[model samples]
Target chain A: MRVELDEPKCVAAGQCVMASPEVFDQREEDGVAILLEERPGDELLDGVREAVAVCPAAALRLVEE
Target chain B: MVVGASAAGLAATETLRREGYGGALTLIGEEPHAPYDRPPLSKQILSGEWSTDRLPLRRSTDLDGLDLDLRLGVAATGLELADRTVVLADGTRVPYDGLIVATGVRPRRLPGDGAHVLRTVDDALALRDRLAPGRRLVVVGAGFLGAEAAAVARGLGCAVTLLEPAPVPLAHAVGEQVGRVLSQAHLDHGVELRTGVTVTAVTEGGVRLADGELVEGDAVLVAVGSLPNTEWLVDCGLAVGDGLICDEYGEAAWGSPRPKAGGVYAAGDVARWYNALFGVPMRIEHRTNAAEQGMAVARNLLRPEARKPFTPVPYFWSDQYDMRVQAYGYLRGHDEVAVVDGDLSGRRFVAAYRTGDRLTGVLAVGMPPKAIRPWRQAIAARAAWHETVPTATPAAGARLDGR
Candidate 1:
């Protein structure tokens, strides 16, 4: 799975980090999402997809390979 | 099958597809339009910053590709658990292999037609049309929706007055100290903040207060919270108190035997489930919880054997003018609040809620989101109040005197 994050559109709701802590983290200064793992294995796909879906700002997107 | 095609229903449908549930799936919604994001209805939509076209929760193409039976403008009148059928308003019964109830809540409306309640897109559009320049907009309740509506009306060049019976505007939800700060923030933004007052009646052109005082306004907005949409499930035999009671795994905890293998589940604001983390049962009305709970219920429906409890750390955020208020965790029985960072006087700080020693909840006003993240973790871990070191100088703690 490939993850794409648009940091400029993030409202720092923290849904992404809550859904997928291993794949996403928030910047210390502004709380914007920071990508930790761009390509995660199958085990983490569900979490990553949830993070993308639950993002209030629609900042995160996933492209399945 | 999923009912109430809004945030929770749409999320559940999407999750079922993602989880490889290729069997027959159906989504039922009373509204004619597809599921749409509701948070912006009071903020951007009312302020005219965002168009109505941008309100949909999912793109049209994505929804079209879901390959599920979409039943719009059809209301579920009753549920027959004996036959696993949902009776519609038109007397047609739809059968399902498994059922997921995500029917959200409806806005509590006032008695008369003088006030408007916003719960749907139509309500927002009607309220938006009345927010003309130089008009008076009196909001009945000072909750999140009321405050946001007042802020939006003020931005639209309307005179906004927020009425609340409590000492402070969000006192019941965020405690008095933080509520006072937020009340001041609204006052700073030129909102006519009225506290310790009650509205007796809504007149044609204004509202009558308890003290025989008449506050004349062009429009009145009734923002007094919401009630769960559980009236249709009266015969479903589910434990419907304030909401549909469910187990931690979102299964209906009803009947004498509490059927474990049945395909009935509940989620979102309409479903009150036991929260293991807080050791209490709660029905969260926030959008984040709705989406998360919907997904959790969908997973449990697909894999009943390995069902996992939906114990999410409840989080909610509200935007009023330039101030953004965010909170996480359960703050119902908190006894004390400590300002760990920033100054309350500046209207930018992070406050932690504690019940004796365990940190129960956290609230941040105008603070960055990153600062609130660790507090969420701390609350989930049940960290001690003293363990959270104050990062700001001159730490100020406020004791919640009553409640």
Candidate 2:
């Protein structure tokens, strides 16, 4: 699975990090999401998908390969 | 069976399906429409930025795939715990093997006409239609909902008067210091903020204050707090205070070990469960908690023997104009509040709420999630205040990024 995040649109609700902390991190200067892993295995797919879904601002997107 | 087909109810249903529960699933909701998210009702939907079609929590195709027995436009009037049956408003009794109550709260209406409350999509659309450009809007409460509505109204070119009875608006929720900062934000945005006064009556022309002062307005938005929908469970023998009392696992707590045969659980704004992280019981009304707790309750229902405690560090966010205020953990009963980063006057800073030496909560306005993420972790870990602080520089290179 591939994760794509639009940092500019992020309101930094922290729902992404709460869901998939291993794959996602927020910038210290701003709360925009920072992708730690662009491509994660099947184990992290569920959390990454949830992070994309729970985003209030719709900042995160997951592209299935 | 799940009562109330909003976020919590939908989440529980989805989780049950995901967890391989093949049993008969029924979702009962009072609203005629399908499950939808409520956060955008006051902001995007009211401001005319987003369409009503975007409000549904799940698409029609996804909901159809779930194969749920959806009973819309019907309300659950009573609960028969002994019989494992739910009494509907239309005098229909629906039996259930396991019950999950997600009946959310309703907006507390003011005792008069000419006032509107935004809780559901219908309420939002009605309020949006009335909020034309150059209309005088008087918001009766200064809570998050009221503040968001006032902001939306102001954005739509309405003259807004945000009236609050407390000395500082949102002081009870976000602490006095942060609340004052937010109150100032509203004033800076040209909102006529009136504090230390109570509304006596809602007149035809406008609202009359306790001191006999009348604030004239074309429209009135009552944003007072909400009350949980727990009247249906009064005879169920479940402990109901502000909401249904439950354990961390979301099981209906009757003070002692269960003598009952059937299972009854609750989530979202309707469930008040003991939070082990905060050492207190709380019924969180936020959207995130509703989703998370609903999933947790579903898992616990499936596996009663291996029940995991649902102890989430409560998080909530509010958008007012260009400012985004986000907070995590319990801020109540905190003695000290320190601005760990940024200047409060600049309207871009992060503050740490502490009870003695332990970190209780973190509030950030315009501060990035990366900066606030560590504080939430510290709160969840129950770390000491000093432990959260990094080096001797204190505020310079003390970012809790790694260690």
Candidate 3:
């Protein structure tokens, strides 16, 4: 599993981190999404997909192989 | 119970009542008065022709018949999602079966003592007092709000100067054709229109430009932009972004490791979600978008099982210097544009925007009745570009009915 993010479209909503905490987090100042650990195990794949679906700006994307 | 009795909140409450929700409604707001018209703040309110007293969303008699427990001058401090209650500034917590978060945005403040922003009624009145005759008014940013302010200040006999960092004013939003009209308006009105300029220094009397040019003004109004008021919701642990995260149906799309709580929803400028037509999740802050979305959220909250998707064509308008500018649909990805009626040089015309072969948006200046409904229908039908051109007539304005 791999994760990609678009910083320009990010509004610091922090939804990506809330959906998959193991893979995403937020910066202190604005709460913009920060990738914590990418290429996560299969157990966290569903959560990653949820992160992509909920991002208001479509700022987060998940690449699963 | 509903806190923040703003446009979205009021619309939600009205919609809920219309849909036969009999639950007791408690509406609270920080303002002493009810929610009122905001757009007028830059126009009539700043011109001193309108007063803040006339801006409430509801009348005492109208609200009296609703059987509502309305609290004014109280602010929502925190949300205890577990308890399903919102904590107010006065240590009062109102619990509700469902919650609607519609605390709208405030103007993004700058780090200065004299600079002002135009978002609320108070802001408009303060700016009005500063716009005395012979005063020099410098406006930063050439967006709709800033442009409108420049026009009003000039109308009040003040010397106005507009500064836009972009190559052309409003080119990013409405394309360069409309932006040229803005530049032309300033030129015609004796306004010193400064494009591709930035304000690097500020003082009590004037602002210094990035190029070392001094724009002397008695008052400077910063109409840069706005940010959502979603600080309290960060702790609620829902999917948060530039706004409170909501799904297509305005439902909170929670993340993993965070517990998903039902009945949590967001609306107005603070709510961001995916627009089916735009193909991207965006945060729209226009008045119409908020009002329509508020109604959609209310209906969905009541009957989630059979709720329809929210897809009203995004539209917004501005009143500036005798021009009633109205735009329909989003123009984010538009690549082709054609002027259907009037001349661009006349500072009065309508321009249609298209992405590939699909008609995506239409913008009109000094012309409202011609563009609104057809643009609305085109957006609803996902009409193609070839299907939206104006019918050719003689030099005297063609009939655009078919288009």
Off by over 4 Å in 1: A1-9, A21-29, A34-44, A63-65, B255-261, B389-394, B397-402
Q: Which of candidates 2 and 3 is the stronger one according to lDDT? A: 2
Off by over 4 Å in 2: A1-11, A22-40, A49-65, B255-259, B389-403
- Measured with C-alpha atoms, the lDDT of residue B317 in candidate 2 is 89
The collision pairs in model 2 are: A30-B368, A31-B368, A31-B369
Winner on DockQ between 1 and 3 is 1
Candidate 1 per-residue C-alpha lDDT over B1-403 given as tens digits, one digit per residue, 9 for 90 to 100: 9998998999899999988999888999999999987888888888878788877877787788789799999999898887888999889899988999988999887666768888888889999999988999999999999999998998889999899988788777778888888888789889999999988888888888889898889999999889999999875677788888898898877855443347888888899999988778999998888888899999999998889999888988888888888888887777877777787888788887877777888888888776777889998887877777443423554444424
lDDT digits (tens) for residues B1-403 of candidate 2: 9999998898889889978999899999999999988988988899999898877777687788778999999999998877889999999999999989999999887667878889999999999988988999999999999999999999999999999999889777767767888989889989999999899888887899999999999989988899999999885778889999999788878734444755889999999999888888899988888888888899899899888999988888889999888889988777667778886777788878777788889888888666777788889999998777533422433232110
User: Where is model 1 chain B poorest over a 10-residue stretch in terms of lDDT?
Assistant: B393-402
Give the CA lDDT, 0 to 100, for residue B358 in model 1: 77
Q: What is the lDDT of residue B11 in candidate 1?
A: 86
For model 2, the DockQ equals 0.44
